[model samples]
Target: MKIVISDYKSSLNFDINYAISYLRDTLGTNTEIIVYEYNGNNKEFIDILNDADALITGYLEIDKEIIQSLNHLKIISIMATGFNFIDIQQASRSHIGVAVNQEYCTQEVSEHVMSLLLALNRKLKHYTNDVDAKGIFDYGTTNNLIRLDGSTLGIFGLGKIGRSVAKKAQSFGIKVIAYDPFISEEVANECNVELLPIDDVLSESDNISINMLLTNENVGFFNMEKFKKMSKRPYIINVSRGALINEDDLVDALDKELIKGAGLDVLVSESPNLDNHPLVNRDNVIITPHSAFYSETSILECQRIACDNVINYVNGNYDKMFRLINPEILK
Candidate 1:
């Protein structure tokens, strides 16, 4: 069997050698594995994927064109939770199996969200930069810092990571409310969070954290109108997909003092022109390079689980493990 691992622009330094060895041991000696460091945009990738039995990708957009070009492709597994980069509908039509590393990075991402929340609430970024760069010794200049206790935290998506964040926030004496249409009120109550409508969550929260997956329905959802509805001027933190927030409107809200600030782990573009981007060089804003999913352990676990999903699927154990994007392909 032929397996191709597309390690596109990966900074995790994933243990590809270990994955290769594991698959070889599980599949057989005849297994051929190709590891490519470049992205899927090149003709070279197209040439290689022509005969691939399975493909594992990192941050590579696999569109309909790429799907149509594959000759013997069985499965395309993404190394991240978000599979929006892949055209799932196109893949489904092509009868190509798609899987995502869904269970990984839950803790890492939740922790990062909490870190950003605390940093914004305590004004850590402002004071740390002040002491190190401006020789300022006074915290009074940053007196806008608020206490997390007795404050409200609104969660946009009450999925696995959202529940973890809610529990952590509760430990800090925060009142947690969440909005997820897919999740029931009973489910939210079990997680110790009040289920509220998006509008109510927006107006009532002291801090709003986005924990939802990015879908076509939610792209640029937090635009000027949504920002205008935020009655408390809440601090917005996004550990989820960046396109969920409209960057232009976010900048406008900050400029108008309609919102307090923002902490973003992901951006619409991973590599933005820093000079012109309004989110950068701002005291109230904190930006992380789409790295809310990184940790020494999470990286390895992600790599392993992604590879294992393909390993199990091709081994004819499709019904047991793995998050399948198109289950009908298995039938």
Candidate 2:
């Protein structure tokens, strides 16, 4: 059997040696494994996967043409929670199964969300820049700091990460409210959060954290109108997909003071043109290059689950593959 691992970016700040070793041990000597750090050539990408039996993709998009070209491919495992880069329907039609690593980085992401909240609320970035570059020790210039205690935290999605964020925020005295259309009231009660309508969450939150999946229904969901509904001038934190918020609208909101500030880990384009990017060099906005789901431990665990899913499927142990996105294709 042949296995391929593609799409390795250096800036993610973690080595894939552990994942490689794990795959080596699990698949054994008989299986052939090749790892490719993708260089942006569409023809080269398709060529690499032409004879692939199983694939592990990083941040590459797997569209219909590529899916159709992957003749022998039985499985495509994504190293991240969101599998939006893959054309699920196309893969299914081609009888290719898809899997994602959903549970591996929940703690890492939740912790990162809290880290952004704390840093933004406390103005750590602002003061650090002020003291380092200008050599000015004046801390009184920016005084938008507010006590997190007794403040409301509105979560946009009540998924595993969102629930974890809520639990973690409670320790900092934040009252958690969530809005997830799919989640039941019982689940919200269990999470100790009041489930509200999306509009209400927008209007009432002292600070907002986005934790939803990126889907067609919610692309550019947070626009000028949504920002205007925020009565508290809330700080917006998005550790989720970048397409969830309209970048231009977000910048306009910051300009008009409709929102207090933003902590964004993802952007609409992964490789954004920084020269004209609106959020960069701003004191109020914090951007982390879509790295919330990263850590030494989390990356290893995520890659393991992603690889194991394919290995299980190949070994006729489909029951063990926990995060299969296109399970029907397995049959």
Candidate 3:
């Protein structure tokens, strides 16, 4: 069996050479892994997947033409939780199963969510900047940097990462509440998180954390109207897909003080020309370059599970753990 890997840059941070070795070892000698840069090059992609039995994609979108060309393809494995880049209906029609690596970095992202919250709550980043320039100006002096001991934490999505956030945040003695339509009430109750609607969560939360996947139905979910509903104007943190929140609205909110502040590790696009971006000059807004799941152990785990999915497909084992969106195509 032949396995091809492309759209690696869509992932941006994944090491292709590491992926290649993992592919070679997992599938053994009968299977080969091909790495191609996915840049809308149909000819190149067609050439690479000409004899491919399975294809592993990173970030690049595999459209209908590409799906049609996967004549011998059994699986389209993506190395991330989101499948918005993949055309699910087309893949379903093609009978090419789509899989994603979802389980590997739940803790990593949740931990980073906590990290961002704590850094903001304790004013760590602000004081670090002050100390960098001179010394600590005054203790707890960055515009009412608050404590999490008796706060209300509102989690947007109550998936694996959301559950992780809840359990961990509860340790800080914060009341955890969640708003996930698909998640069960039992699950939220077990996590000690009160399940509420988005509006109420926005209105009452002291710290708001978003971990929702970005879908067509959910893109730009947090815009001017939603921001206007924020009664408490809590500190916001986004460790998931950037497309879930409106960058311009967030900037305007910071500019106009719509919310308290935001600690963002994700944004709509990788580089939306930050020089001209409105969030660039804000003292309250904090940004990380989409690195919520970037710990050493978590990365190794991601590659391991990603490679496992590819190999399981090669071995005709259709029960990979991390397949998120296109679950029905397996049949």
Q: What stretches of model 2 exceed 4 Å from their correct place?
A: 11-13
Model 3: per-residue Cα lDDT at residue 63: 82
What does each candidate score in C-alpha RMSD?
Answer: 1.6, 1.4, 2.5
Model 1 error, position 257 (Å): 1.6
C-alpha lDDT of all candidate models, in order: 0.87, 0.88, 0.79
- lDDT per residue, candidate 1, 1-331, as tens digits? 9998885464436566777878888889789999877654568888888899999886777888888888689899888888888899889888888998878888889899999999888888898899999999897886676888999999999999999999899999999998999999889989889998889999999999999999998999899999999999999999988899999899999999999999999888754567868889888999998889998788788878888889878877887656888898767
lDDT of 3 at 248: 83
* Residue range 82-160, candidate 2, lDDT tens digits: 8888999999999999988868889989999999999889988899999998898998979978999999999999999
Distance from true location, Cα of 97 in model 3, Å: 1.1
Best by lDDT: 2
Clashes per prediction?
A: 0, 0, 1
> Residue 201 in model 1: shift from native, Å?
0.3
- lDDT string, candidate 3, 1-331, tens digits: 7877766453555556776777776657666666777666788878888888777765667888878877778777787777777888888888877878867788888889999888877777678777876676776556776678889999999998989998899999999988999999898888878999889998989889998888899998989888888888788999887889988888887777779889998778754467867676566678888788887777777667777776776566766545635667655
List of clashing residue pairs for candidate 2? none
Of 1 and 2, which scores higher on TM-score? 2
Candidate 3: C-alpha lDDT: 0.79
What local lDDT score does residue 86 receive in model 2, on the 0 to 100 scale? Answer: 90
